[model samples]
Target: MMKLSLGPILWFWDKCTVFDFYARAAEWPIDTVYLGETVCSRRRELKPDDWFALARDLKSCGKKVVLSSLTLIESEADLRGLRRICEQDDFLVEVNDQSALQLVTAREIPFVTGPAMNTYNAATLKVLAGKGLQGWCLPVELSRHTLARLIQELEAEGLDLPAEVFSWGFLPLAWSSRCFTARHYNLPKDNCEFRCLQHPDGLSLRSRESQELFRLNGTSTLSGSRYDLLRQLPAMADMGVSTVRLSPELQGMEAVVQRFDTARRGKVPAFDPLALTEAPPCNGYWYGEPGMDRVARTNAD
Candidate 1:
């Protein structure tokens, strides 16, 4: 059976909610859990020690734990935090930035690259695979065809890193040094009161036609439509995808996990996973189309 893993939380939530989510996550039918702050370092709801404690707790519950680093490292302080995560010996570290990758490689530590790290071509994957790369999550923007080719190339080289796909949740499209949320509130990034706590699922962005376009959260911009791959489980399995990642959201995550778990076990979920998302569902990038376009699953695409 394909493994089910939870991606690190992309949105800022209160400490209580963070702890509570993990409490419930321990009992979910999840094989792996990623813990850490992958976005703005300022959203420090959980300290490094706190994340390690959580990782250990989850590990104790028989769940594989991975510590994720920030997507965009902007300062020495952020680098320090990334070093701390990479230097640790407990859990596998998910490298989101090149800095994190360099740190791990320098230490000869085994690591996995997150979606944000953009491990697209076979050449990059091959190099990383030789340099202590345990696994990699396909970039969210890559299509299924591209992934299939990458996997074939890896097999040709006898490389054996597990391939993980971002199978659910809103796609994090871009990251910036400036916090868009703070800018929306007309506050500077420094003095910007932590307004991310107010928008749990992220403050939505819409076009002039009132079409949901993107979500502005801290320094990251995400797809307004939730990127769901519930119906693509069988296809992924056929393509030899070893793991499927479900990004954490502020609400309805347990239901999301349940549906994915059921599908991974060869059972069709009774309800549509799209119905659980706050925004319209999309799987465009996965289908080799525009990021917002939805393509119904068929044999080829």
Candidate 2:
């Protein structure tokens, strides 16, 4: 059976809210849960010790927990934090950047590569696998065809690494040193007052015509439209995908998990356009088309 895993919370929430969210998530159908602050290091609602405690609680509930490292490591503090995460022995760590990977490899720890890592080809996968990469979350920009071909190439090389796909949620497009959310409030990045907490889903960036283009979440930019691959579960299963990742949102996440749970159980979920919040659904990247295009799903493809 294909497993469902919840990605780390990308938005900044109150410490209590974060714990409450995970407390509820413990009972969900998810097989795995990723915990950590993957965005800005400053969004420290839950500290490293707090995250470890949460991971222990989730593991007690029978959910495999993975700690994710920061996507961008800018300062010595960030590297120190990454080292701490890499040094942990209780849970598998998701390496989001090359620095994190280096730290994990140096410790000879088996790690999972997050989507932000530049793992485009089989050669890269093979290299990482040699260094104890247990699983990989496919980069968001890659298409289904690309994934299928890469799997074939890996097979030919006698390399087998579990592939995990980002099945749902807003695609994290990029990260920057400048915080757009802070800029919106006319504050500097150093002393931005953690304004991202105001918009739980990150501040929406729309065009002059009011077309939603992107979401400004601290130092990260995400797709305006939520990426939904509910209809592609069957295809993913056929491709031998070990896990399907569902990025956490502020609301309706339980319903989203239930829907995905149903779909993976051999039921074709009714495609409700409003199942996700904010902008419309998009799966074009799966079909090698524009990221925003909502291409109809067909088995023929």
Over 1-301, each residue of candidate 1 has an lDDT whose tens digit, in order, gives: 9999999999999899999999999999999999999989998778999999999899999999999999999999999999999888989999999899899999999999999987879999998988999999999999999999999899899999899999899898899999999999999999889999999989999999999999998999999998988888888898889999999986788888988998888886656834654688899998899989888778773
lDDT per model vs. reference: 0.91, 0.91
Stretches of candidate 1 off by over 4 Å are 270-274
Q: Which 10-residue span in candidate 1 carries the lowest summed lDDT?
A: 269-278
Model 2 stretches with alpha carbons more than 4 Å out: 273-276
71-117 per-residue lDDT for model 2 (tens digits) = 99999999988888999899999999989988889999899999999
TM-score of 1: 0.98
Q: Give the clash total for candidate 1.
A: 0
